[model samples]
Target: MDTGFFAPLLTGYEWQLSLYAAVGIAAVTLIGKYLVLLIPAFRAEHARNAAMRRSKMTKPHYAQNQRWNRRWGPVFLIAIFVGVLPFCLTAGSQPWWQMLLDIAAILLVYDFFYYLVHRFLFHDGGLLGGPLMWVHAVHHRQHNPCRQDSSYIHPIEVALGLGLYAGTIFGLSRVLGDFHVVTVVLTWVAFSQINLHNHDLWETDRFPFRYLATMSRMHHNHHARFTGGNFATITLLYDWLFGTLDHGHGYGKTKVAIRARSDASGIKKPPAEAGG
Candidate 1:
């Protein structure tokens, strides 16, 4: 394939091209993540699971959180689009093969740095005071998060997280001097899809993308009882390298650990495993 085969497609209208790409990414991600719900068997299974989970709930359940996520999700997506726009417009000129390589490197770097930011800065309450903690707390509220919950984050969290990510990518582009915009856009889409898949409540046992099942499982554990570990959103490389990868006690079953904050005491409990 010619390196510049698609160059003309994005030659003049960089911002508009980026916007269109973002829209396409959103469309594909939504359809891919929730497409399983269209399958009769999978839909029935999800329904049964939802029913069983609701039956044992002591508080408002999935539907409530899902609705809340849906309400605020578009705002979060717009924030992401704004955050990514600069990088997309400033993408460097590079050969297609080299651009692909750069994209892979950027993704790996983003994953590592994000794991650090997520675990130490966002989740570790001792490091920062009230406001920052509150940002991440919104995400943890829905332990059994649905697809919409993927982007259902506080604006502060979105600003910090995506800001850091975009800043890093731009910095790397400047240093390398040939990081293409197409690479950045592709990586952004992948990043968004992976986060969505991680938060999706659907079982992935028979999914065509079986390789991503590990990520799905690790993220589930992160939401379940092993919140302290498995902080990486896209890949387990950082978590595994740092010894924070907790696969949990059970493989197939959900660990019933609720992260609750006590209003009066201002202290939180360690995730306690609930009996199955």
Candidate 2:
């Protein structure tokens, strides 16, 4: 009953079974994120165009997003492994719920780090200014991003995910305990999937599931202006708590833009250019 004590929560479960379960969760979550967000978001765009009897959303541009993803997706996926696998290996013998909570706390910590890295480091002329900025710019260049396009990130940024999350687990486990590491890894895997789903276009009314809707809208706006607002990857609490959320940018506007991209070439033209 010692709250301060750190120990593995699972003893009856076989190590092999635990390893398999962790891998299975990672696989299912990965596929779920891609299919749920990218596929539906893409389909929604197509449906919108078809309903309007217009074919402005060209297949080539749509495919372009896919191409970028295909070329780079594996690398990004590797980051997931780099980030979660080691931690899982070290701490897979914990209570499932404890693992889940650890994952959540890790995600929150990493998300905040992401926000800081994104806002100050990526934006400012700091260490991330040169390489990270260039890589991320490819993403920003996509004015009207497809749902799947959300996966597009500079390899540099992708690398950070691996380092920040994995490195955190390593450092924390040394101080906290081995079982806690597994918990955090599982949580991160779940979070990675959630982030993927939220970024891609898929309608949902679920448990706010990490506040996906709010975060998705914020990211959409970031794409909207090609800059600014909604920096947090996992939760809006950071932005909301830190006075960074753009309340004026209503969800209505975001929906319109999303629908419009769906109806058009799947490429979002600048608002000014669209007007002219």
Highest lDDT: give the candidate number: 1
10 residues in a row with least lDDT, candidate 1: 250-259
Question: Candidate 1's error at 213, in angstroms?
Answer: 2.5
Considering every candidate listed, which one attains the maximal TM-score? 1
Error of 1 at 66 (Å): 7.1
What do the candidate models score in CA lDDT, each in turn? 0.62, 0.55
RMSD of 1: 9.1
Q: What is the TM-score of each candidate against the true structure?
A: 0.64, 0.61
* Per-residue lDDT of model 2, residues 17-113, tens digit only: 3455457667766676467546554456435424422222245654555466677757755554544444434533566776666666667777888
Give me the overall lDDT of model 2. Answer: 0.55
Number of residue pairs clashing in candidate 1, backbone atoms closer than 3 angstroms, sequence gap of 3 or more or interchain = 0
Q: Give the TM-score of candidate 2.
A: 0.61
Q: Write the per-residue lDDT of candidate 1 for residues 23-110, one digit (tens) a residue.
A: 6666666776498678775576457555644553444554565466566656665755554453445444567888788878878888
Report the Cα lDDT for residue 107, model 1. Answer: 83
All predictions: root-mean-square deviation over Cα?
9.1, 9.9
